[model samples]
Target: MATSNSRSCLKYLLHLAHDNLDFRLPEITALLALRGKPFHPCENFREKAPFWCLNDLSEEDVHSIMTRSICAKSAFELWGHGQTHSELKASLLNYPPENMSPFTHKDSTYRINVYTFNKTLEFADRIKRIDALEYLSFEGTVSLKSPQHIFCLLEDYGTDPNNIPEQPNYIYFGRWIADGQRELIRSHSVKNRHFIGNTSMDAGLSFIMANHAKVKENDIVFDPFVGTGSLLVACSHFGAYVCGTDIDYNTIHGKGRSSRKNQTWRGPDENIRANLRQYGTEKMYLDVMVSDASKPVWREAALFDAIITDPPYGIRESTRRTGSNKDITRPPEESHIPVSQAYHLSDIFADLLNFSAHHLVMGGRLVYWLPIYRPEYCDEMVPHHPCLRLISNCEQTLSSHTSRRLITMEKIRGPEEVDRLAHLADLRFSPYQGHNAFREKYFSGLNKREGEDV
Candidate 1:
């Protein structure tokens, strides 16, 4: 008979979806750190400390990875990680433990994005595993289930199999990464309200919020520049209450702001409304207000457990005005008239850091994305603050229209602790550092004695 301790030694199967090859090094590192394991980018999975069976887009490759994996999980909507399409196709073809008999103790967990389900279900059905499919979490559209349709599929159409397990022991709603959660937050509309100049949140914000959701619950989440309340919407969806503030009144009313005519233009703009209607919540109350993110008027709400926002990088209307009437620059076409001086891009970061320090609760995570104007500025800006400590520089990315630097910091006190953290941040931002070392150190601590099982 197998020993109780030995039986509990789980074989975790990890289905690594492809992330953009550009800026996901930090994101990859953060996942390993959170799991308290070391991650190696190469193909040898059998002997690794975490024993992750990673494969990209191909079903054949996924079958191969699962055949070798003991306990498996799936992650979806991975974009641009593989170098070629052939490589991606090879990855997915490797799933469902290829040609093996389904066993009673077969471990199962599935993670997917909302949009990928139509494709994912086809793959999930192929896995002939005999035991429970315990965990189910998604980052895609939650409204797709259409309860009636799901009932029909399960009961009448006989879609879901009889042998499959009933309910998951633990389930999470949102993306596998924090950045996915942030995007959902950014896309949200405040009671069907639109925004004047609010655009989408960078990819990393979505990753960070998803990670934060695992640890924080029943906490008030704050997004000062709520703009249509994307971040607030994500937090609310994840079972957390949210409070948001934006200066654009039109954003709170769903009416297009006069300055930002493109947001509410009735022509192509019908897409946003259509998508919301798809979720059956185009008229949902967002609980957001028209207030500046720099200065929030939070009411009876408790201190925020976390703060995640994409502060304008001077690419939007925020850049149009600065201190006085001096003109900064005009579009080449508008040489006839000059506009107000745009704010120095550097000042925006300075203000964002200061504003976050005031609102975020101690020990609460603050994940924000910034366009890198000057890398050296991060150095000068970091150590000056006493209340905030730059925890991790989750690498950098060239996001749409801007090269972004993702900085994850925590609110804390004590000058000495913050000082030490500054040195750590410096190492993290340095090329070829932080990620591997952090994972190595953490995994070693978790696995101090060899042969002593987890």
Candidate 2:
């Protein structure tokens, strides 16, 4: 029997998808962190590469990672790797014979797959490559349709379409383990979803945010600025109890203009809860309310395990919060609700950070997007709080001069009075404080070109 000791110190090969390169590391790291494992990449680790060899992980750990990773395509148990096929053979030979016996045993049925990155091999050539591996004695019966065990020979042709190399830059051989949850992206696509908004989060990105927050089974997840509960849908799929609040009554009630091209209006059944029900995650649905994020109504306690949101940046949706020029001490009556004025970009972030600090459990994460005018943005401009420690800031460029950063932060300490008031008193947020400041900056270049035409 293959024992835990036999799996110890064995390296794992991650076959990551080429897209969403920026979000890959943090997603994998956060998933591993949930399992109490630190990321230990093997030698010559390239963060941008399609393949990553990881050490200090067991087969179970790899399985756990594959369950949650959207940025990854598949995973394998790395038996050998080298700069060349000859070197790969030497490495495979050096591998302990005892480790090879279990898979190559006479009773087993197996098959080999040849996967090449950045290049494709002809069928005959692929057959020739597999035939070259005859040096490794295999006593198992060949089974192509359904195999008990599978091995793979992976070739890394340097990632350049223009300059195709005659030889592969690297080669890896491994035992197939598990595939990642790439199917989730297609299954949970917003195009197929029951409810969607103009700025509903993309299904892939929603799952990435949930992974970044380390959302797990039975965990409570919240989205303060929820729009059709896209992030909540992703969180609920991972077995988390999901709820959210939106200031837009139409959105909260799912009774608004349809974002679909041909659809005139949403049906009565159209709602966030219905979205969960469509995905068979209705049990994970808590509730969504029409409430202001700035003036949070939740009790003063850590009630959520993760807070994931995508605040409106005044492009697809307008940013507004309840208030008026007139100063009224008491609450407004039911007859006349307060008018919503422009909520500043700076204050939106300030309120979000403060709210997260107060509401998220210790070590729980706050994942959200921060819009940036690319030229004016610096690391210092990322909002900070004493209670929340900034984790990762990844960019998804929108235009030549504008991009939004996905920022992940973990709550380290409970809020202090000093921490709650920091953003209000800080001088750093002055640049984008104006309600239309970011909006104006985002459109300046476009307007300039239009004026040039005029």
Candidate 3:
């Protein structure tokens, strides 16, 4: 009986996927932020819990979220919930009959399903659970194959799989509204991709980064250290115009050795634009250039709407830039390539923060990965700039002692706000004071796992 405009009082239950626990809240929060809405979680809020109850959201809002969310599996209209079956019956009975009337009408066809988290149930047990919901008046006829209205009985047996409780810690009854975009993970997998490399990002995380960047239709996105254009492929899927720059000419031009096994050389079409074309978003491909990220080739202007990338941390790809020890007074010949030098992880982040602050439009975002030496990673080590505000920091652990944090920041003030003595001019470039400091720390963690002396 709730009108579309009056549905804010209705609560929605989100069934989030079990993986990527750290990224879920930020992804949902960012998606909600896209609609000019704040994340309003309800009682029994646990960061790692599979089910989350959110308040003050309309059904339309839920659909919009599910359309873009890779973290969530499905969403429901929370009709009633309780800690026990008897309590759940009481809660369901207490729900206004007017709200139930529309879906439970005699002329409507409906089906009831039972879902349990952290536990598997026999078919009989699932059927028994569904039959228990007979306490609620259902005037509709049962239609298992195709139902006009679908309802669910969800039970939470707690998160401990090794110690699942005999009874669910909680119970919920709701109308199934929509499912999330989780299929994108498998469909856009790197294994099936046309263009790939030694370090192409996984599909699910690419979508998550695009979601965190809050990329939308017509938005212009840029990647500073794009490898195989995985991030650009993700951004273009969201209708954003995508471009990038990488120091490696072979990578940018899709030449040289192929990343795929048994293939000695890359195909002529194995390029970033082709990757976007593989996903049917080729029209959104702007272009990628073989330019150094440290020395940005763009004119002095705020052109990008969102900048999303994953810089090399020396695990698979070496981080180098166009540079030299001795300064040359004259420019080299047009075809001559400059000698390369080490691009320290510390300076990488420093340059990234500064570049993002000046290049991103106001309210635009800069989403990138910062490798962490887990033991030494304090929040202070996240580089800062006057014009950018840290938004969300989520971790994706690679090893026992090594991980990378996905840091999302937004342009709060214009580039003009950056002033000498007010911002980072006096601050340390990063906690990684020297090139060896970062490189050694990163490799030492890996060495520790291999039983080698650091």
Candidate 4:
């Protein structure tokens, strides 16, 4: 029998959700990085595959990841895996008995669960599959209701639902460790939230943004274009002190017409602070104010641990900033009353990146969404800053011709480290200038689609 001390040599398997295929790897990598561990995949690793075998991670590391991951469904300590049943049996036979004995001991209670990916199996077939594992030594009593340990036999039928293989492409057996925080999506759903807006982020994606920002206990998070504080609510749940700034006074105060159906006006307590109170994280609320993100109000210093925001793309909401026309002259004293001007999409991103570079602490992150016109989108279209390093770009398609990329960047150096203006000389930054016309192009696409239909 393999001793418990040898467990560190075992490989772990992460059963990731099939959805959010593009975001899974970055989410997992960020979670692993939170623990100061690098992502180490085993041989034949597939990024889009449902199951991933990770090496050089301990049981504790797996537990930490599962506690925060929304991409992964479950994780397990891999005992053995193979391409076929015969190969699986041979692999299991080769597994050290010393390690298996602790769980399969005479006085232990255990249960085996059968799981198939992209395919369903009948109860009889599931039983037959479990029965095939008889080759392994098991002295434990079978406990269906309550077991001291749970084991799983997972079969991967490949990713394509239209082309599922007749037999599993691979098989794996392992002891279940922990399940991921996928349930947070349902439990924190915006449908039941106290405060919401037309642009309020979905609960699952909000949590994913927080994770990508590496938000943890005692960290400070800020959202510049916080519509209804949806991002703040997610960060507060993770023990981060949350604050935000919105240009709309009505939104910051939550005193305008209600976004809810059948409601004409917002109630007295319909606000971001109340939203935090609803989630039992009111203590993490710092404050929310009506401030222009284009002209940051924070002092000249590293202020926040992370800045996670969703700037308006002029789709559901019109993107505007507090300003008058450059040629217009302001009258005395009346200048206090702010006027509005269209905030071009290109300038929005440029300002956001520049603001994050100044306000975020060293090694802190900035995670935000960048709307894209699929036909004109390219890697260079992403905005860059000298102090920040681009981390990941994951796309979420909104339509046949439109999508949004979640861009994550980390501040590697301070403003003094490099000439911030140097990048402006490069033509790469000019690619995003096309984004200034995004709104016009967006409506044009809709009109073109309508024409095609006619």
Candidate 5:
């Protein structure tokens, strides 16, 4: 029965969704460390899996843990835990946090959780603020770690109160909790960013911040592939000084019908004007540019506190390298560009890791979306980089064209400090490649032909 602070211990069962389970351990560890408390990775790993025991923890603590856990690296989404085992489920419901207190529930602490069950979250009500006694259906209930308190603390440290919302329900709980329902419960900085864009928000980015990047006032956040400036918007909502860049200006600035489209051509100045107005950014222009991510010359050394990005898929619209004098309109005769022919995306990702390591302080993190075709390609690119460690890869469903891979890397003692780097590169890439059921289905239809033959 360990205690975190004034509060005692509480047990939470986090059933992580497949590969995302990898982030659970690191996410919890990061949050605890930020709160002036640190938990051992090996011991805390249990709390991320089948059942996690967070002794003397608050709702904000849990929320941050879930945020980062879902974010990859240090964050992730909650699948149902313990309950997967019927016997465990029966005992867990009775062990809700409300029933116990810091004094009485020392060892057998109460746990609160909101999980994705059959697509929808089971305890969306209990996620934000936890009072062991309040049922999920009630109103005005707050998790012991109130976000308002966290906001106040940020304010005392010179954060903008305008960044903090009036309502609690506006916060995020992934897509499991519907928007309207979330508005009814709590208001969150992450939710504001998710609703601004036309497409579904990048869950990987949301997951990582929820875990690793602690939102202090004026904390600088950057994303090289600032697609619609989603990460910046999210960080700004959370009181961070956000900077982002992209090769395309039209996607950021074009207004009206054209602004709504992606590949249309536009200029950097126009994009900057539209973005500044759209996100209500005033006085200072966003530290954005149309620069290439592979080149580290754009900004000074050790400038950003955090880095997050989603690189382009080679399968889509061709991203021709600049300084070219080739044909103006028709497609290039060659399908593949030589490594020297163009800035290889694999190299961009590896470079992103290296550059972030140089800019980020120790314990800083970088979240990037890696498309998995040949895992070996990614492994080879970042193989022995001392500046970062590949923490986790959360499998996601992006578009029809690309296979989503949410990769989280941390700055651990630089590349020179890395003792060893290994990963379970084994992925069921084809979705149903080696399953027995798939094999049986394909063979069964062909094997049973005319009924009489042997």
Candidate 6:
């Protein structure tokens, strides 16, 4: 019975998890964009707040976002909200009854849940709070076990735990819509995965990277530094056709010693293809191979829709590429032996960006992590390319002195758009020179901390 005017003005509420605060906006925005919707926040929106009010989104849009979101815990169809309980009541009264009657009808069963952020309430107080909502005309029977409709009264007690307030800083009333895919974190955890390397990405972060890249069904996704194909697994779950390349032969063949405790050698079936089968996404697996990221293996055409990967930080893994010392004599072709030299962090990022620039289709995205030394970190330190535009850079701190940033870039123009000579002439287009010393700075900080402890 809702009027067209009222339905058009309806707003949705998102209750986001506090962890990974920096990645929330980008994740939600990308999800909304997937549905051809723009991120339109209501007035006085706070990015850091646990609750977010979004306007101009349909119920279908909300459902779509919930199906994919890992940062958002749950979403709701907001009925009312205000700075105080009394104000909340006033706001609820102003909501159109025609829009509310279907769920609150006489035959329907419903339940009211009280959720408080940053504070815990006594059982008695929680009961009192729910009982106070009697002002709304809910003709439905109270069914806690299985309700047709669920309403929630959420209270925000500010983020500071030390200075808890007597009353909530804000209150919201909404009908619960759907919960996010946070359960994927536990279900796909690397600890439980069949094939994992020392630096296998966390399942939660791998999914987040796929989301940031806007990986969608049937899209071809690739990872150049695919170690154990963690990123590929996340993309395959989203219905993408995934493939990747790595320089290590043992890793590509899954013939190395096992990383798990009490295990010696890897099982014969312990491989990237088997990982996709474990998650029932084997159909989406294209292939993986042993190839250096610095070398061009693919044809000179844009082949990938998205590139999501976690490059080595040179901590647990060594950054090496196929190379030989300039002074070393070359062996005969028949008796040639493969040799590897150090791959500088700066050059790694440069090759990654350049590779993505040529191989990613126009509008395709590349999402990867860049290690940073906190003391010398700057925006300029992020590698850039003319054909690709920087989208988002989110920081995930590892320790007091070291952190890695998740960098997302979208290819806006094809390689033909820029002159080859000019692109190389620009110093900014090169890899950040400072990154070459990151390994030194990282260890220096660790040594300084050790000295302090003594």
Q: Give the candidate number with the greatest lDDT.
A: 4
Over the stretch 74-153, how does candidate 3's per-residue lDDT look in tens digits?
99988899999988999888887777777888999999999999999999999889888888889989999999989999
- Deviating ranges (above 4 Å) for candidate 3: 1-3, 6-8, 329-336, 417-436, 452-454
Quantify all predictions' global Cα lDDT against the true fold.
Answer: 0.40, 0.90, 0.88, 0.91, 0.44, 0.90
Q: Which lDDT tens digits does candidate 5 get at residues 176-220? A: 210111221123332433222333244444534434555444667
Off by over 4 Å in 6: 1-8, 327-337, 417-424, 427-431
lDDT of 4: 0.91
Any runs in candidate 5 off by more than 4 Å, and if so which? Answer: 1-28, 39-51, 56-60, 63-216, 255-285, 325-341, 374-384, 397-402, 413-454
Question: Which has the better TM-score: candidate 2, or candidate 5?
Answer: 2
Clashes of each: 40, 0, 0, 4, 44, 0
RMSD of each: 16.9, 2.0, 2.2, 1.8, 13.8, 2.0
Q: Candidate 6, overall lDDT?
A: 0.90
> How do all models score by TM-score?
0.47, 0.96, 0.95, 0.96, 0.53, 0.96
As a whole number from 0 to 100, the lDDT of residue 2 in candidate 3 is: 42
Question: Tens digits of per-residue lDDT for model 6 on 267-309?
Answer: 9999999999999999999999888888888998999999998
- Candidate 3, pairs of clashing residues: none
What residue runs in model 2 are displaced by over 4 Å at the alpha carbon?
327-337, 424-427, 431-436, 448-454
Error of 3 at 64 (Å): 0.3
For candidate 3, the TM-score is 0.95
**Cα lDDT tens digits for candidate 4, 270-389:** 999999999899999999988998886889889999999999988888889987777666453664337889998888888888888889999999999998899999999998888899
Global fold similarity of model 1 (TM-score)? 0.47
Q: List the residue pairs that clash in candidate 4.
A: 1-97, 1-98, 2-98, 2-99
| Weakest lDDT window of 10 consecutive positions for candidate 6 | 416-425
